[model samples]
Target: MGVFTFTDEHTSSVPPVRLFKALIVDSHKLIPKLWPQAIKNIDILQGNGGPGTIKQINFVEGSQLGKMKNCVDELNEETFVYKHTMIDLKEKFEFIAYEVKFEPTPDEGSKNKMTSMYYTKGNVELKEEDIEAGKERALGMYKVAEAYLLQNPDAYA
Candidate 1:
């Protein structure tokens, strides 16, 4: 399988604890509220906000983004590190696996370094244009969430 990787970094004025709580713990409820046009809903299929949890993300109808199933693989609250894998990709292209890791920058003011990887099935061909589009969408989603948190500090507390 071919491997594709994407990385993003953002500095948040909010504290790391608050940022992690909002982005990971309450993400299912907060994301749709922040970007209704892109994410219609996030349904938790199993477990709480810990590892082994399963989630289904439903994108808004007619949106370029497609739906996918995610499973939390690792979560380190003390370090604000989170990792998840795409268990299923029914709506989009063929991918054997996908993983995202969020790491808090030490000595930085609530900054986070995020890395994402996608392992595609060997036979499946992924176009560069499609990958670029996905990256843009992901960044857009993060920006929306950041904006929401900036506006409402008490959210997800």
Candidate 2:
């Protein structure tokens, strides 16, 4: 298998803890509500939502990807860091690993960073265009959460 890594950063006017809470702690509940047409729901399959937990994300019908199963590698509320690995992408990829960190800025805002590692099934080389859709979706999700928090200042505070 071959691995390709990509990193992206986003800054938000919202606080780190608040963004973290909305994006990581409450994503299962918030994502589907925000984008009902694309995401059906997120279900916890095993564990108590901590490390080693398994989760399934079900997408709406006719979507490019049907569903995904992931294992939670790390979830730190105080530090605002989350890591998980997708274990069910058996077609083109062996697995995909992601790490997200929300850091507090000097202005009390947030600087969020995301890293994704894609493990291909064989010697296949993955290009930017090959994963552009997933990248856009990930960024869109973050923006949605940011907007939600900005609209509701008291939320996740």
Candidate 3:
């Protein structure tokens, strides 16, 4: 078992509270609709929209990722912190986890800053390049959601 960790941060024009609501709260229903080209559905398999919930994200037909499961480890709406453990999507990536913190940061008059910490357990020795693919996927998803909110100001307002 090889363990590796890294963090990636994104800045957006959206406010922290609004972004948190849209990303953590409304994502279950909104993500699939917003990114139908990549994600087909997000189904909550267990628990409420809180800690201990197990959710599955189904990818669009013919994608490399057919489906992926995640366990909500922690969610704090007040502090805008979210942590989830990802089930193995592909055989090589055995266990992947994330702790994401959303905080208001000063940046060109925007209140959006997202810090994502990722932990991955690989089946064999992992290189930095091996991890970029997963990080790109996460970034892609976040950007899509952010774009949706940018276009619809009233959404999750």
Task: List the pairs of residues colliding in candidate 3.
Answer: none
lDDT by residue for model 1 (38-118), tens: 889999999986889998889999975478787888777777777887776653345433333344456544776767676
lDDT of 2 by residue, 52-94 (tens): 9999999999987899898999999999999999897766899
Candidate 1 lDDT (Cα, 0 to 1): 0.72
Best by lDDT: 2
**How many pairs collide in each candidate, listed in order?**
0, 0, 0
Which candidate number maximizes TM-score? 2
Runs in model 2 deviating more than 4 A are: none
Clashes of 2: 0
* Residue-level lDDT tens digits of model 3 in 83-143: 8888755656666778877777676223443344344444466666667877788788788
- Model 3, position 152, has a per-residue lDDT of 92
> Which ranges in model 1 have alpha carbons more than 4 Å from their true place?
90-108
